[model samples]
Target: MVSKALIQEISQLEADFCSALSDPTRLLIIYSLADKPHNVTELTNELDIIQPTISRHLKTLRDRGLVYTVRNGSSITYHLGDKRLTQALDLLRAVMRDRLKHRASLAKETKATINA
Candidate 1:
């Protein structure tokens, strides 16, 4: 059985980390950084988002400890805080795909029933 304190910790972490990921643009940024670190300009070009928007999302990610930055001369590059972040995202995507497939099958069954 899980302890109440553990559940509370999980809740706090979810609030901290998952809230940062609530935006699709942020998710795209995460995916973009999975390959390699990038500065704001590079992320803007890669994700086709405006530099300001990318900076805003990056700040959110940085605040959540989801990404870390390194400085090279005047440029600052962001890297994923942990590789497992992408793995977790991939797992969520798989779950979403499974849910959609299930819903499609249910819809097909309902349509067939109506026709019958």
Candidate 2:
């Protein structure tokens, strides 16, 4: 049986996971990692974010089990803890694209009505 404490723990973890993904910078970091693992310098260059900012987001992702890091001498490379995150992000992007298309269509129709 699931105890109250267990449920609360699960809820908190879920909240943490979602919270970790709530930032645009974090999402960009996840997307950048989707291609392959990268060290802080690489991520900072690709995302145009500062090294410290990337490190901060990486820490949050690591805490939430959303990313994994490997240390090689002085360089530490980060990768997605679960590759399925790319799939999730792709799905969300598809939804956003659909919504944007719908909004554009509505605007076009309104413009046509005004022009008529």
Q: TM-scores across all candidates? A: 0.89, 0.84
Q: Rate the local accuracy (lDDT) of all candidates.
A: 0.93, 0.90
CA deviation > 4 Å runs, candidate 2: 1-12
Q: Clashing residue pairs, candidate 1?
A: none
lDDT of 1 at 94: 100
Q: How many pairs of residues collide in each model?
A: 0, 0
Error of 2 at 33 (Å): 0.8
Question: Candidate 2 at residue 24, lDDT?
Answer: 97
Give the RMSD in angstroms, all C-alphas superposed, for model 1. 2.0
For model 1, the stretches where C-alpha displacement exceeds 4 angstroms are 1-10
Q: Write the per-residue lDDT of candidate 1 for residues 2-83, one digit (tens) a residue.
A: 9999999999999888998789999999988998899988999988999999999999999999999999889899999999
